[model samples]
Target: MIVLLGITLAVVILVVVTWMLLTRRLREKYAALWLVIALAVLVLGIFPQLLETLTGIFGVQVPANLLFSMAIVLLLGVSLHLSWELSQAEDEIRRAAEEVAILRAQVERIERAISSGKASGVEDADGVG
Candidate 1:
């Protein structure tokens, strides 16, 4: 009964992930990760006893503990990657804002000079009219 349920769930998840990928809602990189996870679930679903064997091999008494530990590690890795990406994005944004500020200041100065009859639109920034 439980085996059948696991297989069904795994198939459903795989189908959902594939559909999302085809619809362009999910990128190929993320889709590949989801596919890997789904395949792992499918394999475990197909061989329910594999977890038990793995636990024995790893000298773990409870299989759930092993799963929890693995899950926590995976989540930590994902969290770290996301944090790094966010930091990179923030730095890029800051640099872009600084560039924009510099350009705005230059434009304002040019407008002031042109209005004061110091330089025409045809002249360069160094007042080479």
Candidate 2:
């Protein structure tokens, strides 16, 4: 009963991750990571003793401890990746804002020149005025 439940849960997770990828709700890289994780879960479910062997190989006393440690590391890595992406987005936004300010200043200058030229009755078509 427990083995069947574990397999079903892993399959469900795999389906959900694939659906998210197809719907464009998740990025390809993240989807790939999830797919790998789901596959690992499926393998672990099919052969529960694999986890025990892994724990022993890694010098861990309990399989649950190794699993929790891996989960924590994965979460930390994901958090770091998101932070880096946010920093890049912020840098891009700053550059875009600077460009907008420069363009706004140019537009304001052009408007002032046009108004002054009209008032002084010295309209130059080439804008040499």
Candidate 3:
């Protein structure tokens, strides 16, 4: 088991390093998060007892697969939250675009009125005595 952990840790380190190099992103940007995940997988893959210990914290007596399934559900919850925020932003953008279009049309109408009055040599009633 110890050997397996060492191997897994080495593999994870190598893969993370390779990814960071390929992406050209500062490792610090993602290093901490990936390190935690790699360490978790390495620990869990090699020491099943760790899962039992973790489950005990939540009063859970389920298999590791169930815990994995719960993680998937949590990811879906995050995705749903992001989707809701995007939907709200989209609605706000649409409303803003409509308002801008209306304002542009009003400005165009005013401009046309001014040009036509100039051509006809008529005083703007609102502006004259």
Candidate 4:
């Protein structure tokens, strides 16, 4: 019964992840990781012995502890990647904002110069004023 439930959940996750990838809601790189995880879950559900073998090889007392440790590690890696991406995006935004401010200042200066020129009638059609 538990195996059936796990298989069902794994299939649901697989379908959802595939849909997200197809809709461009998730990037291919991230989708690849999610697909791998879902497939791993499905395989483990189908063959419960694999986990037992792994636990035995690793000298783990319980399979659940090994699974939990792996999950925690994967989550930590994902969190770190997300943090780095966010930092890069923030830097890009800051640089863009600074460039915009500089451009705006230049525009304001040009406008002021144009207004002053018109007021002083310093620009003449004859090319001399």
Which candidate number has the best lDDT?
4
Candidate 3 to truth, TM? 0.52
Which runs in model 4 stand beyond 4 Å of their true positions? Answer: 124-129
User: What tens-digit string does per-residue lDDT give for candidate 4 at 1-129?
Assistant: 989988998999999999998899999988888999899999999998999999999999999999999899999999998899899999999999999999999999999987888789787556765
For all candidates in order, the CA lDDT equals: 0.84, 0.90, 0.73, 0.92
Writing each residue's lDDT as its tens digit, candidate 2 over 1-129 gives 777887998899899998998899998988888888788888989999998999999999999999899889988988999899899999999999999999999999999988998889785887664
Cα-lDDT of candidate 4: 0.92
Q: Which stretches of candidate 2 lie over 4 Å from their true place?
A: 124-129
lDDT of 4 at 99: 100
Please give the ranking of all candidate structures by lDDT, highest first, separated by commas: 4, 2, 1, 3
For each predicted model, how many residue pairs clash, with residues at least 3 apart or on different chains?
A: 0, 0, 0, 0
lDDT of 1 at 19: 95
TM-score for each prediction? 0.78, 0.84, 0.52, 0.88
* Model 1 Cα lDDT, one tens digit per residue, 64-115: 8877777798788778877997899999999999999999999999788777
Candidate 1 weakest lDDT stretch, 10 residues: 116-125
Clashing residue pairs for model 4: none
* Residue pairs in clash, model 1: none
- The TM-score obtained by model 1 is 0.78
